[model samples]
Each structure stands twice: as structure tokens, then as C-alpha cells.
Target chain A: AQSVTQLDSQVPVFEEAPVELRCNYSSSVSVYLFWYVQYPNQGLQLLLKYLSGSTLVKGINGFEAEFNKSQTSFHLRKPSVHISDTAEYFCAVTLKGGGNKLTFGTGTQLKVEL
Target chain B: GAGVSQSPSNKVTEKGKDVELRCDPISGHTALYWYRQSLGQGLEFLIYFQGNSAPDKSGLPSDRFSAERTGGSVSTLTIQRTQQEDSAVYLCASSHNSYGVEQYFGPGTRLTVT
Candidate 1:
């Protein structure tokens, strides 16, 4: 079975500050990684994904992530965040050929303050 | 184009009652999935439907939980004899295919069992 682990339950940062949300996964086979953000009273929106090729994958809203095969991690990072970036972020994983069912992590709440 | 949509954004039902949550995936999407988000479980995949393939019920918690996708577009997650434990947000997502692709999410249906 595959699983995702998000070490940080909550991360507080000031506006325009950099932010990083750490994510680790346990999977025996190759897997696809993804980052999703869920704002207050809204559905989850895709932030970025790492499928193949480049280890550095960029996503919408100026967010990006690096897929480290050796470390089994896909950490989300943003050079600078805005107040609107405050949301709960989730890291997910799915086996390469194991269908599209996603194994999600316990989300990390990113609280951006002014 | 419109994204995935779920009905009855909020549902309040009494314990022991039954509830049905609906999900309308993006048109032409070949894969649909159901997930539950709760304080205890976080986010967990409950079921998945891909075209005419057999639906994946392996993630379902118990027999009381069931889901079906009709015409490969709309899906319904039925929870029979709901319990407080079932009080959570039921989210639906859809993807173009069952492979390594982005899955769009719906706003989710918040079910509260009193």
C-alpha cells in the first residue's frame, strides 16, 4: 500500500515571505506526486504535479515542487506567498499503473498573515 | 469549461438515516472518484469509476457505503444508516483518463449526521 506523510500540520508565514510544505511518501513502485490546495469553503485546486521527466515541476500561482526520488519526497515551495495563498495544502501519491485512486496526506494548513 | 460539481453542498441528516451525495464530473471525463474528508481520517479515497471498468470499492470503509456512476458521468455515494463517524465532506473528482493525469475536484458535499 502507498501512503503520504506531511510532517507539518500547520505553517504560519507573513505575506511576501517564502514558504515550503514538506511531503514524503512510502511506495515500493514508481508513483505520481501532486500538490493540491483547498481554500476556505472551496473545493481543492491543483497546485502542481510531478509525473515524469524533470524533477522540478512548476504549478499555478507561482508554486513549485521538486520530486526527489532518492529521498522519496515531493516538497511544495513558493518564493513568496500572498494573503490569498492561505489554505490547506495536501500532498498526494498514486502508483504509476495503480489506477487513479489517490492516497492523500494529512493536509498542512498554510496561514498567511499580514 | 465548467469543472466538477457536487449537489447539496451541505447535508444534515439524523443518525441511522440514509443520505445520498451526488457528483457530476466534467463532461467527457473517463474517470471519476469519491473521497471522504474528516477530522479523524483526513482525506481518504472511497471509490472510483473508470469508463466501463469495474468500480473500485476496495477503499470503502464498510458495507454501508456504496457508490455508482451512471452513464459514466454522474456518480452518487450512498451512505446507509449513517453514523456520526460518517459526518464529513464527501469530495468527487474526475480525470480525462485513469492514467497519470490531473484529476479535477468538486466543491464537495458536507454531510453532518446528528
Candidate 2:
């Protein structure tokens, strides 16, 4: 069995400020990690994923995340955030079992103020 | 649909009413997923369909919620005796069964139960 945990429910930052959204997961086996962003009244958009190889992953909109195996963390980071970056972000995981089952974090809302 | 498409885009119903939401996945995509996002919440997995095989519905909240796929092309999710708690944005996504590929999401159906 596996589970996903989002450490923060909301994050607020001024424009151009750096921001980070924390996520963690626990699994008994190998897993795939994903980050998705949802704008107001819109659907989720893929931000980035950590399937294999690179631990430091880059995504759209100048966002990035680092997968820490030891910490069981996949935290998203942005060096400089903009007001348009305000949205709800989700973290998800998929394992080999459960027939491609995906487990999602509760969610973290990012608010970037100008 | 060139992308994952879900309808009706918005639905308003009273408690105890039954509602059916539909989804059309991307062409040739072998994997389809349904998720729901409540206000100020993250995405919750509901079910998954792959090819013509039986769906993985382990994430279904209860027996009152059910879904089906037809001709391996489209899907319909039915919620019986809808409750106010069922009001949320239902999202659908599709991707090839291949690994390392990201899922493409639909705009989603917003259901408001009065």
C-alpha cells in the first residue's frame, strides 16, 4: 500500500518571490510521481513528473521539482513566481500494482499576489 | 476529441437526483481516468479504464457511484441520489498505456447539487 501527503494546504507569495510546495509519498515498491496544476475554473495541467533517471525535473512555466528518495519528497519550486501562477496544485503517484492505480494528495493552493 | 472531453461542462441538480457525466478520451489512447476536485481540495481518483478490459474502480467512494465504458471509446459516470457533498468538478484524462507519458486532461464537468 502507498499514500501521498501534501504538507501545505495553501501557500501565498508576492510576485517575483520564490515559492515551494511540499509533497511526500510512501510506497513499498517503485512508483511514478507527477505534479499537476489547476487554474480557476479549469482542469489540471501537467507540470512535471519524476518517472526515472533525473531527480531534478523541470516543467512548464519555469517550475521545477526535485525528487528525494531518502526523504520521500517531491517538492515543487519556482525561483520567481508570478500572479498568473496562482492555482491549486496536486501531487500524484502511481505504482505497478492496483493496475495503474493513482493516488493523489489532498492539494495545495498557491496564491501569488502582485 | 483531439483531447480528453467531458460533458456537460456544468450541471445543476437537486439532492436525490441522479446525474450522468460523459467523457471522450483521445484517439487511440488506451488509458482513461476519472477524478473529482471539491472546492479548495485536491483531485480524488474515482476510476480508470484501459482498452476493453474491466475497469479499476477501487477508488469509487461508494456503491451509489458507478461508471461504464462503451465500445472502448467513451465513458459515462453515474451518481445516484446525489448529495451536496457530490458537488465538485469532475475531471477526465487520457493517455497511452505506455510509460513515461503524461496524461492529457479535459476541461471537466462542474456539478452543483442543491
Candidate 3:
């Protein structure tokens, strides 16, 4: 069984400020990690993914995440945010060779305030 | 090129009634997935279908939830005897046959059971 945990339920940051959303996962086997964002009344969009190559993966909208295998963490970060960045962020994981059935975190709501 | 699309953007049904939600995957995608997103409850995997192999229903909450993919393209998720708890957004995603691919998502169908 695999599971993902997002420590923060909501993160409120001012415009132009940096932000980081924490995520951790527990899996018996190797896994692939991903970050997705959902705007109000819209479906989720892929932010970034860590398949196997480098630990630091850059994503759309100035977002990036580093895969820390030893710590079992894949935290999303952004240098600065805008009001448009206000959305729900989700961290997900899937087994390496088992199947693509992703296990997602509870989600972290990113509220960008002016 | 059209992305994954879901029909009946919103559905309101009475409790104990059965409802069906539809999903049309990308034209060449061979992997499809169904997920449920409830208020504050992030994304929960419901089922997964990959290239004609037996579907992995491990994530389905209960027997009341069932899904079928016709011709490995379009999918229908049926909920029998819907409950208020079943009210949520049902999301569909599809991806290429390769492993660890990013899955494209649809807007999702919001179901309100009263």
C-alpha cells in the first residue's frame, strides 16, 4: 500500500512572496511523484513530475519540487507568487512498475493575498 | 486536439437513485483513471484501466461504485443507490501507454445528491 501526506492544509502568502508546500509519501516499492494544481471550478493541471532522473524538477508557473528519497519528501516551491496562483495544490505518487493507480494527498490550498 | 472531456458538468440526483457519469479519454491514450474529489478531501482514486488488461479496482470505496471502459476509449462510472456522501466531483484522466506519464484530466462532473 502507498500513501501521501501533505502537512499543510492551507498556506496563505502575500503576493511576490515565496511559498513552499510540503509533501511526504510512504511506499514499499519505488515510486513516481507528481504535483498538480486546481483552479476554482476547474480540473487539475500538472505542475511537475519526478520519474527517475534528477531530484530537482521544474514545473509550470514558476514552480519546482525536489524529490528527497531518503526523507520520502517531494516539496513544491515557488520563488514568488501572484494572485493568479491562488489554487489547490496536490501531491501524488504511484508505484514504479506495479501500476499507475496514483495515491494523492489531502491537498494544500494556496491562498495568495495582495 | 481536444483534451479529455467529461459530460454532464453538473448532476443533481435524489438519494437512493442511481447515476452514471461519462468520460472520453484522449484519442490515442491507452491508460484511463477515475477519481473522486470531495470538499476538503482532495483526490481519491476510484479505479484504473490500462490497455485492455483487467482494471485495478482497488481504490473503489465500495461495491456501490463501479466503472467500465468501452473499447478502451470512453468510460462510464455508475453509482448505485447514491447517498449524500456520494456528492462530489468525479474526475477522469488519461495518459499514454508509457510508464510514469503525466495524465491529462477533464473538468469533472459535480454530483449533488440530495
Candidate 4:
């Protein structure tokens, strides 16, 4: 079975500061990785995904993540964050050739302060 | 275009009662999925439906949980004899038929079993 682990349960940062949310996964087979953000009272929105090709994948709102095959980690990063970036971020994984059902990590709440 | 939509954004029901959550996927999406988000469990896949294929019920927690997709568009997740443990946000997502496509999520239905 595949699983995702997010080491940080909550991350606090000041506005305009850099942020990184770490994610690790355990899967014997190859997998696809994704990052999603859920704002208050809203559905989750896809931040970025690492399917194939480049290890460095950039996503919306100036966020990005790197898929490190060696460490089995896909960490989300943003050079600078805004107060609007405050939300719960989730890392997910699914088998490459298997079904599309996603295995999600315990989300990391990003609280951006002024 | 409109994104995935879920009905009854919030539901309050008593224990032992039954509840139904609805999900309307984006038009032309061939895959739909149901997931549950709770403080204890984070996020977990519950069921999956793809075009004409057998729905994957492997992720369902128990027999009391069931889901069905009609006309390959709308889906309903039925929880019978709900318990306090069933109080959580039920999220729905949809994706295109192609491999490695992103799954768009809906604003989840928050269920509170008293």
C-alpha cells in the first residue's frame, strides 16, 4: 500500500518570508505526487503535481515542489508568502500504473502572519 | 467553466440516522472519487468510479458506507446508521480519462452527527 507523510503539522511564517512544507511517501512501485491547498470554507485546489519529466515542477501562486526520487520526498516551497497563503496544504500520492485513488498525508496548516 | 460541486455544504444528523451526500463532477470528466476528511483521519479515499468500470469500494471503512455514480456524472455517497465517528467533511473530485491528470475537488459537505 502507498502512504504519504507530512512531518509538519503546522508551519508559522511572517508575510514575505520563505516557506517550505516537507512531504515524504512510502511506495514500492512508482507513483505520482501532488500538492493541494485548502482554504477556509473552500474545496481543495491543486497547487502542483510531479508526474514525469523535470524534477522541479512549478505551480500556481508562485509555489513549487521538487520530486526527489532518491529520498522519496516531494517538498513544497515558496520564495515568499502572503497572508492569503494561509491554508491547509496536503501532499498526496497515487500508484503510477495502478488505480487513481489517492493516498493523502495528514495536512500541514500554513499560518501566515503579518 | 464551473468546477466540481457538492450539495448541502453542511449536514447535521443524529446518530443512527442516515445521510446522503451528493457530488456533481465537471462535465466530460470520466473519473470521480469520494474522500473523507476528519480531524482524526486527515483525508482518506472512500470510493472511486471510472467510466463503466467496477467502482472501487476497497477504501470504504465499513458496509454502512456505499456510493453510486449515475450517468457517469453525479454521485451520491450514502452513510447508513451514521455514528459520531462519521462526522467529517466528505469531499468529491473528478478528473479526465487520461493518465496522470489532476483531480479537481469540490467544496466538501461537512457532516456532523450528534
Model 3, residue A103: what's the lDDT?
A: 86
lDDT of 3 by residue, A32-100 (tens): 999999999999899999998889999999999999999999999999999999999999998988888
| Residue-level lDDT tens digits of model 1 in A1-114 | 899999999999999999999999999999999999999888889999999999999999999999999999999999999999999999999899889899999999999999
Question: Which CAPRI quality tier does the interface of model 3 achieve?
Answer: high
Stretches of candidate 4 off by over 4 Å are none
Point to the candidate with the largest DockQ: 1
Q: What does the lDDT read for residue B82 in candidate 3?
A: 98
* lDDT tens digits, residue span B1-114, model 1: 999999999999999999999999999999999999999999999999999999999999999999999888899999999999999999999998857799999999999999
The runs of at least 3 residues in candidate 1 whose Cα sits more than 4 Å from the true structure, single-residue gaps closed, are none
lDDT of 4 by residue, B76-96 (tens): 999999999999999999999
Per-residue error at B10 for model 2, in Å?
1.1
Q: List clashing residue pairs in candidate 1.
A: none
Interface root-mean-square deviation, each candidate: 0.6, 2.0, 0.8, 0.8
Taking the tens digit of each residue's C-alpha lDDT, what string does model 2 give over B5-108? Answer: 89999999999999999999998989888988886555778998988888888888889999998888898999999999999999998888866568888999
Give the range where candidate 1 chain B is weakest over 10 consecutive residues by summed lDDT: B95-104
Question: What would the TM-scores of all predictions be?
Answer: 0.98, 0.93, 0.97, 0.98
Q: Per-residue lDDT tens digits of candidate 2, residues A1-114?
A: 888999898999999999999999999998899998989888789999998998999999999999999999999999999989999998989885445656889889999898
Query: What fraction of native interface contacts is shared by candidate 2?
Result: 0.67
